[model samples]
Target: MSWAVLVISGVLEAVWAAALDRSEGFSRPLPSVVFGIALAGSMGGLAYAMRELPLGTSYAVWVGIGAVLAVAYAMITGAESVSVLKVLFLAMIVGGVVGLKALH
Candidate 1:
């Protein structure tokens, strides 16, 4: 259950990160509100999951998931360009996340 919560939190982290990009520095109303709420909810879920999880492991996994997802989205959505090197870096993030999950 804690891992599930952490995964959900990771997904929400991606959603909120995308929302933040679309918010245009909070000039946009709807996306800004959604971004704020999603960010808070993501943190809340992380806190709940941390009750039973090791802090270092859980936090690393959570951030890694978010980083990989965000980079993928950026590549797909043209917000950021993709390259072989960048993809390799993202792969490393995935490996780190997986390694943490395996340990946990």
Candidate 2:
């Protein structure tokens, strides 16, 4: 359950990150609202997961998931450029996250 919540929170982190970018410094109402909601949910879930997971492991996993998803989304939407090296790095991040899970 905790892990599930953590994963959801990590996804939310990506959502909030994208929404925040779309918000244009909070000038946009809808995206700003989305950012606020997702930010709250992500933080809440992270806090909850920390209750059961090791602090370092939980934080690293959460950040890893969020960073990978956010960059992937940006690349998909053309907001950021994609490259072979970038994909390789993202895969490495995923590998590290999985390694942490396996160790846990």
Q: Name the lDDT value of residue 35 in candidate 2.
A: 100
RMSD of every candidate to native, in Å, equals 0.9, 0.5
Runs off by more than 4 Å, candidate 1: none
> What TM-score, over all chains together, does every model reach?
0.95, 0.99
Q: What's the C-alpha lDDT at position 79 in model 2?
A: 91
**lDDT digits (tens) for residues 1-104 of candidate 2:** 98999999999999999999999999999999999999999999999999999999999999999999999999999999999999999999999999999999
Best model number under lDDT: 2
Candidate 1 C-alpha error for residue 88, in Å: 1.2
| TM-score of candidate 2 to 2 decimals | 0.99
lDDT of 2: 0.97
How big is the RMSD of model 1?
0.9
- Residue 31's lDDT in candidate 1: 95
Candidate 2's error at 72, in angstroms? Answer: 0.2
Error at 103, model 2, angstroms: 0.5
Worst 10 residues of 2 by lDDT: 1-10
Against the unseen true structure, what C-alpha lDDT does each candidate score? 0.91, 0.97
